[model samples]
Target chain A: MKTIKDIAALAKVSIGTVDRVIHNRSGVSKKTKERIEKIIQEHGFQINKTARILALNKKYNIAVLMPTVESSSDFWYLPKKGIEKASEEFEMHRISVNYFHFDPLNLNSFKDVFDKLLENSFNAVLLAPIFLNEAKERLIYLDQRKIPYVFINAELEGANNISYIGQHSFDSGALAAKLMSLLINTEDDILIVKVRRDNVHHSTIEDRISGFKSYFNTRKTPIQIHEVILPKIKDQETINTLLHKKLTNHQIKGLFIPSSKVSVVANYVEEHKLKHLKLIGYDLNEENVHLIKNETIDFLIDQDAFFQGYEGTKTLFNFIINNVVPPKNRYLPIKLLTKENVKYL
Target chain B: MKTIKDIAALAKVSIGTVDRVIHNRSGVSKKTKERIEKIIQEHGFQINKTARILALNKKYNIAVLMPTVESSSDFWYLPKKGIEKASEEFEMHRISVNYFHFDPLNLNSFKDVFDKLLENSFNAVLLAPIFLNEAKERLIYLDQRKIPYVFINAELEGANNISYIGQHSFDSGALAAKLMSLLINTEDDILIVKVRRDNVHHSTIEDRISGFKSYFNTRKTPIQIHEVILPKIKDQETINTLLHKKLTNHQIKGLFIPSSKVSVVANYVEEHKLKHLKLIGYDLNEENVHLIKNETIDFLIDQDAFFQGYEGTKTLFNFIINNVVPPKNRYLPIKLLTKENVKYL
Candidate 1:
């Protein structure tokens, strides 16, 4: 029930000084700011976010930089839907989002999109740092320009981002391994399928593989694990031959696909009428969901990419408008989906 | 960019009428409201929620009615934490929540709490309709009094509640059964344990058992299933005797506890040194979580009771302030947790 005036009076500071401290404005000295904050905390004083937003009446522009939906196996499409939903909700507050797409394969395309985004004076940015080196440089420039950004779906190490909303790739991979272990016997060997494509986000996939291996390492009786890297997923005959070779050579009972391109291998399994082979993969894309429904895929570790984009945008806006500091890493729940539980999710 | 005045002029209605329609006030005619809404939708006109809330400047009192945290195996404790979180967040908006607790053992206690809540002038209500018949009568009374209520943790059939935010009991059980099937061989039999206590929430437990049975029924190789109803969980000797008899009489490789009181059976298993038996149960309570961490419990079907309480409270507040109509049944994701994924969750 305490007001700003009460906080200022208690702290022996001017109302303007208290206001600056409340808004996280950098005018007040550290000592004065601490005193005012102490009083506010002691009294449980709340800054009226609704009134503050109404008073500012400022329009904010947010730039979204990520690969196009068509750029990476339609995985970005789910997050795009989530972004649009957030856009519709936040539009009431005069917040507008402009999207910039880059091709995941081409470094030139990534650079061009970053440059185009830099041309605009945006209040904030939400991006997936898929191209590590290029994204790091762009992020430094953004920091110099004093524009806050949120990283979605991908994290760039040591970047000055307000928040990174995504999954813990390594933990998710470990979770997938746990589920896979439950499906197959200890003696039965497992295959880790890496469906290669141009511009594949390698760090996430590699972390997942590491996590999967870590889980098995902890087990008393370590199961035999094999890896098969397919050069390109588009060629059906080539994929069939590669997978056929692995299955025949080893007593493989389960397939663990580390990326959203799980449908490619799922299609191979279905076409070859491979029975009793438990398939576990990532994402809940249209094709992945269909494969899961038909029992081609047994378990899926959903990163909830939709929530990453949606929460990333919302977090950026809250920081810009309300001076709310978000957690540096907002690791979403590693959701495990089967056909029975998929419908509810 | 369309203003209220523009909407008013375009709808051929007065600005006051348009305002009333937007606020869902009863004074505006249905036809006029629809016409104004049509124009607003066509132009994608957004009503600034922040400005409207600031303008209203009304303090809302929400009444939360549920069993005490100590009632029924400490399952309500998780949701209580979630409710407190929502309370802290919404306190900034002059929205206050008052909690009313009832003893789960006594129906009279539930009636007494409802009566006490009815005396207060609450803008909204959030409750768990654990006592079905009693809740139905109270819900009818609330409908007559025109106070919106959100159901959390439990649902009443055919009630005029604004939203029911919780897990689908049947589906969660089915999901649990799927996990159990993966853990044990098809030839191995399973035991369903029901820990009995006074004022047990029978509906949820029954639905879960039905869901578990349904899953096995769908399988081509039907596994033998047995049920054990422990009269009370306090006496370790009694629990040990009953479980010993079942395990000795059958080829049981898995134990499915259909309630939050899974720790009782988990403790029995640990004490008896029953190895290679998969223990799958419900909830993320302190004891269950501890059991899972030590590898005593294999899999947990998390209802996410925290989210249920959190979303239930938020939904009620949005309905009261922003006139947001929530989906009647907000079925949360049936989350499966193990030692590997439990930390991340």
Candidate 2:
């Protein structure tokens, strides 16, 4: 709340002299300017910038890196819509978002797009890391240039990042485990099915699995846990072989599919008349919604994809326009969706 | 996005005439004013009121009504803090909240405070309804007068109100039952313990029970349910007798208490070494938190009372100042809380 006049009084200078020091104008003496600057910094006197913003009408371009929406899973579509909403809201403020999507299933597809993005003069970026190691290495240049970047959906640990807006995957995974523990019987074995159709175990998904295991191990729950991995869901032979091997081998009571591709598993469950088993999945995409409504899937842990996208874009815009640093890691609330609450969320 | 000049052009008048009409000045003829007003309404053109707001700088009073935070169960305290936060955030915008507390255990106490609130000239109100029928009846007058009101924790159904921001109790109950169905055995009896220390069968509680039963009945889940209603949880003989009878009577494997006073039952379970029973309760108070961490309680459905309070005050302020109509029923997301994710929410 300290005004320029207050700073000038503390520094024993005129308001005009303080203004010269603030704007780095030539009229003030070097000694007086230094004294006024010291006073301004000491008092944390932030001049109201609304007027200055109008005077210096600036346009900021932010790049958004995400995955192409897949029909098998349109989970990324919600976040895309969120980004669009934020972009439209901030349009009058002279901020524009340039979306650069990559193939979520292909590592080289992600690298190729990020490589092209490095050539642009964008103010900041919000990204979802698909190829983890390479994406972190490529983003090192942004850190060196002090161009702030935010992560959405997928977070990179022990990296130079401005902010992360997504669910805490490990905690979310643990939550899924807690849900699984609630519904599964001790006599029945639980399966941790990795529908690795993308041929990638993203860190977020890995952390979720780790967290899920930690929850069960910590409490020493007596239920048996089994693991199975399937190739790309589109590969009929692979899906059939994996499903047959797992389903025929064990008297599975519950299945935990950590990715949004739970819809794929839900399909197989319905087709095979495996209605006795309890199922916990993720995200609330159209396919998941239908399966959940029919009771093929019991509970879903929603990552709040729309909010993640909005906050990611909003955070980057804040840093570029207002120089405000968002919370380092903003963990979105983990929402458990059931037959009754699914429609509301 | 329409301007005064646009209205003036359409009305065949000068900008001054339009301005005068907008400000309700006497210089303009009534016919000209009527023409200009129609033009403004047709276009959804809003006058620039920032200058008028500063020129008229008026203070607004918002009344907050809720149960007093009980020393034993501080459930109401979270909402109180949220209201305080929203009040502080809007202080510079010329808004203040005047709290009217009531003993939640007594119906007459609520009537007394509401009667006192009715005498005040407050611009708006945000309330947590207790003794539902009476509260709704008293609030009808506010609706007739067009003084907007928002409901926070407990919502009124089939009422004249601006907005209701709270968790959907029935859906939340169904969610709890879903969780309970997951953890409880087919042969085990589930106890619906009504720790009615408050001596009110709040509709919120009844709705949650409905939702719980609906989930079990629809799914045809084989768990048997038992109900126990206690007038006062603090009465030692009653608590002891009920606990003894329920603990001894059936093959009880899980207990469901749809209130924040879950701590009362949790304490009994811990003291009597009834750790095998899977329990699903509500809220994230200190005692329930400890029980969850120590593995005595299985899961706690978070109502997010803080967000409910903040949104209630904020929504009323928006309507009073900006004339924004909030969603009629804003159901806060239901969160399934565990030891791992409790710290984050």
How much lDDT does candidate 1 score? 0.82
Error of 1 at A284 (Å): 1.6
Q: Which DockQ values do the candidates obtain, in the order shown? A: 0.54, 0.42
Best by lDDT: 1
Weakest ten-residue segment in model 1 chain B by summed lDDT: B195-204
The residue pairs in collision within model 1 are none
Q: Write the per-residue lDDT of candidate 2 for residues B1-345, one digit (tens) a residue.
A: 467778788899999988765543457876786677677657756546885486337788899888887563488888888888888988887887888998766678888999888888788888877578889878877765556788887878876566799899898998888778767677888889886645565778888888998889997867788888866766867887887898895588888999887877888888888878878899988899998888788889888888888888888876676544466789987878777677676
What tens-digit string does per-residue lDDT give for candidate 1 at A1-345?
A: 477788888888888888776655567887887677666656766557677767459888999998888643488887888888888887877888899998655668888999999988998999988767778877877877778889988777888787788888788888888888888898889999987554545557778899998889888555899999887766888988999999895588989999887898999889889967999999988889999989999988888888888888888877777655566788888888998889888
Report every candidate's CA lDDT: 0.82, 0.79
TM-score, B chain alone, candidates in order: 0.79, 0.83
lDDT, candidate 2, at B191:
89
